[model samples]
Target chain A: MIGRLNHVAIAVPDLEAASAQYRDALGATVGGPQDEPDHGVTVVFIELPNTKIELLYPLGEASPIQGFLDKNPSGGIHHVCYEVEDILVARDHLIETGARVLGGGEPKIGAHGKPVLFLHPKDFNGCLIELEQV
Target chain B: MIGRLNHVAIAVPDLEAASAQYRDALGATVGGPQDEPDHGVTVVFIELPNTKIELLYPLGEASPIQGFLDKNPSGGIHHVCYEVEDILVARDHLIETGARVLGGGEPKIGAHGKPVLFLHPKDFNGCLIELEQV
Candidate 1:
């Protein structure tokens, strides 16, 4: 089952501008950008009191977010992550309930070095959901 | 300054189905729907440990989310709300930094009964941001 709301990922066309907007305009503590080759994105974490806002930018040629950026040129909220106690259990329960998991239904080590799986957006009211083991 | 991420609002085409999905598939504690006429949406809150996921549906004829739902028929993330110590101070600072506030630059009573203001999505990496005085 989902526990805590992990982070909301926003795919931005310009990572630096987005980071600056959060840090200066919003007056929030934002971390430096870190390239996530495995995830095919560069991420900057905006630390809030209760959760994080992840600014994502396409990293490589096959960056998954590139398509998202193509569709949303100015970028948009890409996904919302929820922390789960036991990911396998959560996946199985979700499967039994007819929810489809993405990427062949296998958990991959996420950007945070935690096991994570993405659920199909269609099954989740058009919201891409990432379940991270915590 | 932005303090806590109060909630992430997801505009859904079908409110009941979306609520059921969160309640049954995601195993989240979903609250009953409350029609916020002034905000022009009916909302169902999914209480997470640290924050909340608000499921929004069009309430009346002039529902703001109706346009969003029209563009994204399956529904999608509408906005992200962040708590602020003082909304007016935050507004003035944001304005000084060239960020545009929506709704004629005045704080309106949000669905949570708190003073809230929406920022222009164009200036916010294409994400609608809501600032709530908490």
Candidate 2:
């Protein structure tokens, strides 16, 4: 069962600029500015009362953010993460339903020290989704 | 300040099919099958622990869902709703910051008996967002 919304990940052309906009314009507080070299991207997290907002920008040319930006032309909502009680169980359930896991192995630590995994958009009718265990 | 995530609205070609899939595959319980004649769509709401998932299908040919489906093709996440303490204040803040409101008016009762308003995606860099006062 879905627990709660953990965060909404947005792909931005510039993380710093977007982070500033969210903070100054939306009355949100920034939680982080972290770099994930493995994913070829950098992120800034904004904490909300019940859920957080993560702004993501490509760190390199081959990052997925670049591709998403190319397709949408404008930065937009990238994914919605749902908090789960157990990452492994959620992962298995998703896989059992023929959903493709973006990463080929077990759930790993994602941005902000949370265990997470991604389900491909292809299986969910073009909605990229993240499952996290907090 | 934001209260919590109220729901994530998804544009879909067929609400019944999508709702069934979510219920059967995700083990979620359905909360509503509502119609918003003004918005030209019918929606099905699936309640989660802390947030809800809304599957929207156009009721008329000129409905916004059709446009979104055309733009994304395979169907995808359309918008995220954030719960707020006061809808009027949030609306004023967004407008003061030069963000456009999709429907120019006060918060109206939306799906699941909540007062809500929408922010145009054009101002948000391609992300339609809703604000609900719960």
Candidate 3:
């Protein structure tokens, strides 16, 4: 079973500005500002009591975040993450259900080095879902 | 400050069917299948470790869930809720920032008797946000 909610990812045009607004308005502390060269995006995390909020911004012209921003325009939720006991099990279950795995392999270290993997949004009716094991 | 994530609401075509899908797929036990006569929605709750998942289906032709489902053909997330220490404070803060309050006043006892209020989607970039205090 999925253990708990890990975080909710939000796609933003500018991570810094979004982070500042979230901090000032919600009083959430910023955790990290890290880059994912593989995905061509930069992400920052804000920790909350039961879950974290991740702000994502495209790092390059070819980044998926840019496409999402262009499509949504208003910068809303990008994905919802569920913490799992085993990433491989979750990935396999999703794969068995014909869901496309974004990373195409076992989970790798994510923002805080926790094992994480993302499933394609198409399979979930336009909602991106991520599985993480800490 | 937002204390935690209270729930994630999904607009579905059928509450019972969606509840079954979520229960069988994620092994989450169903909590409630209550009706909101005010909003014209029949909602089901599935409790998780730190948050709840709410499946909402329209009760009448004028229900907002119908409009949401009609707009987004493919079923997707409807709203993400944050638990607040004080619903009035949170509502006031959001209203001061020019966000329209859907309920137009202090929160009332929502499902399970918690104070809850929803913000107008137009203000939040098409995302329906709910503030709940439990």
Who wins the lDDT comparison? 1
Per-candidate interface DockQ score: 0.91, 0.61, 0.55
Question: Judged by DockQ, which candidate is best?
Answer: 1
Query: Arrange candidates by DockQ, highest first: which order?
Result: 1, 2, 3
Candidate 1 ranges beyond 4 A from true positions: none
> Candidate 2: deviation at residue A50, Å?
1.2
Question: TM-score of A-chain in each prediction?
Answer: 0.99, 0.85, 0.82
Chain B TM-score against the true chain B, each candidate: 0.99, 0.83, 0.80
lDDT of 1 by residue, B35-69 (tens): 89988999999999999999999999999999999
Error of 3 at B67 (Å): 1.0
The CAPRI classification for model 2 reads as medium
Clashing pairs in 1: none
**Candidate 2 stretches greater than 4 Å from native:** B105-109, B112-115
Q: Global lDDT of each model?
A: 0.94, 0.78, 0.75
Report the C-alpha lDDT of model 2 over A28-90, residue by residue, as the tens digit.
Answer: 788667888877788888777767778888887688789888887669999988878888887
**In lDDT terms, how accurate is model 1?**
0.94
Error of 2 at A38 (Å): 2.3
CAPRI tier for the interface of model 3: medium
